[model samples]
Target: MSGSGAIVLNETVHQPTRLRIMSMLVSVDTTDPLAYGFLQNHLELTPGNLTTHLRKLEDAQYVAITKEFHGVKPRTWVQATAAGRHAFAEYLTNLERVLGVRARP
Candidate 1:
């Protein structure tokens, strides 16, 4: 939805960790792969916790995961889908408007 001067996101993406994950994905360019360990350390999540969250995101089609071997180790890389980016941007825009930082356009 359009707000003061930006778009807004629905309440569906309000969770802190999910938001952070989306934020981080938006910050990257190219297909720069990220390891599960990277997210684990960054998000301070246990393996199970991270997997559970990732599964939810994946089910929502907000993120994609690729499983492969990195040399001798299995690597899991995460990326946000186009839909995810749009939703996150909308959420931020709406949030900005709610915060009175933007005008509904």
Candidate 2:
């Protein structure tokens, strides 16, 4: 094993797609969830790809998904939970620890 410190990463949120998703979700006001279509477009991911990433985060209780129908049209919304934000913060700290340095930019 490498001699790196015992830094633990939230592997679920560490996935690139999921990282981007959580970043966007946390940046927004927690009151409103990002619309499914908007997230797909902004992340430049296909519906299926986004859904797969979302399912992982949802399972981790990091992302909340809401589904409803708008005049018979199905709509989905996603937001980062408080636990998600805390976990993301810890993830960053661990990453910095593993790097043996920290920079915010």
> Evaluated with TM-score, which candidate comes out highest?
2
The candidate scoring highest on lDDT is: 2
Compute the lDDT of residue 17 as modeled in candidate 1. Answer: 79
**lDDT at position 15, candidate 2:** 90
Residues 10-77 of candidate 2: C-alpha lDDT, one tens digit per residue: 89989999999999998988797899999999999999999999999888999999999999999999
Taking the tens digit of each residue's C-alpha lDDT, what string does model 1 give over 1-105?
544545445655678878877778777873675677888899899999888878878888888899999799888889888877787787887788677795657
Error of 2 at 9 (Å): 1.4
Candidate 2 colliding pairs: none
lDDT, candidates in the order shown: 0.78, 0.89
> How displaced is residue 82 in candidate 2, in Å?
1.3
